[model samples]
Target: EAGVAQSPRYKIIEKRQSVAFWCNPISGHATLYWYQQILGQGPKLLIQFQNNGVVDDSQLPKDRFSAERLKGVDSTLKIQPAKLEDSAVYLCASSLDPHPDRNTEAFFGQGTRLTVV
Candidate 1:
């Protein structure tokens, strides 16, 4: 199976600007997730989708961050008016099921590193 794919391995923008990132998951995978990883910190779940429906997005900054997985295959995340604190690595991951269990392990993409000045 193909691994997750992400575009623009790096991005730089000024505060209050807007940027977008894209992700493509493995074939036949029905679960996808977006996470933000700050330097020296673990990945924080931002949004999760199961077959095009959002399963969780409690940690996502709704005011500035938005995402969608329309066909349950690929997803996109956008940050509007990016803040200085938003500079971090955005990672996309996928698994066979949306729920976490002992059997499934999420595969991560290389990630897009965002830098806000």
Candidate 2:
């Protein structure tokens, strides 16, 4: 009955610093996702995981961003040498199923807003 959970609702860092965010998906959900949202832009999928296995991460910036789903439950996203462009909200979402064609809707957590000075 509970929804996804995220930590550190807000963060501020200077450019080139490192930041990390945490997420805990809803119970019974097998599909978890991490997204980045810049102001005025829609959420961009950074990575996706199905039961601890990576399903997709094509859009993730491998040079500076990384993510992992541990034991098919909790997840973490990190950005090293953060740039000013990385100032955005980091969102976590989870769906009950992994199949995209399924009608299940994803539940989102309160995003962590990162500000790079």
Candidate 3:
């Protein structure tokens, strides 16, 4: 099966600017997630979608970060007025929602690396 896909594997932007990342999950998967992975830290859940409906986004910083998975297939994440502390890897993962805990075997893409100056 095709795996998750992300773009602009690397990016460099100045602080207070804006940047966006994209993701395409595997086919037939019903659950998608976005995570921010800072250097030396594990992936932190940012946003989660289940069939186009938001399941979890409590960890997302609404002040500067936003995301959408309109059709439950492809998704986009944007960071406006970026900060120096925002430099990190944005990882997208997808899984088939087949369990009660909503935890399926998620597949990760080669994340987008952002560098804020």
lDDT (10s digit) by residue, model 2, range 52-85: 9999999999999999888999999999989999
Which consecutive 10 residues in model 3 have the weakest lDDT in total? 95-104
lDDT tens digits, residue span 42-112, model 1: 99999999889998999999999999998779899999989999999999999887455545688999999
Candidate 2: which stretches are off by over 4 Å?
none
lDDT of 1: 0.93
Per-residue lDDT of model 3, residues 1-117, tens digit only: 789999979999999999999999999899899999999999999999998999999999999999999888999999999999999999999999847886699999999999999
User: On a 0 to 100 scale, what is the lDDT of residue 34 in model 1?
Assistant: 96
Pairs of residues at least 3 apart in sequence or in different chains that clash in candidate 1 = none
Colliding residue pairs in candidate 2: none
* Whole-model lDDT values for every prediction: 0.93, 0.95, 0.95
Can you tell me which runs of candidate 1 are displaced by over 4 Å?
99-102
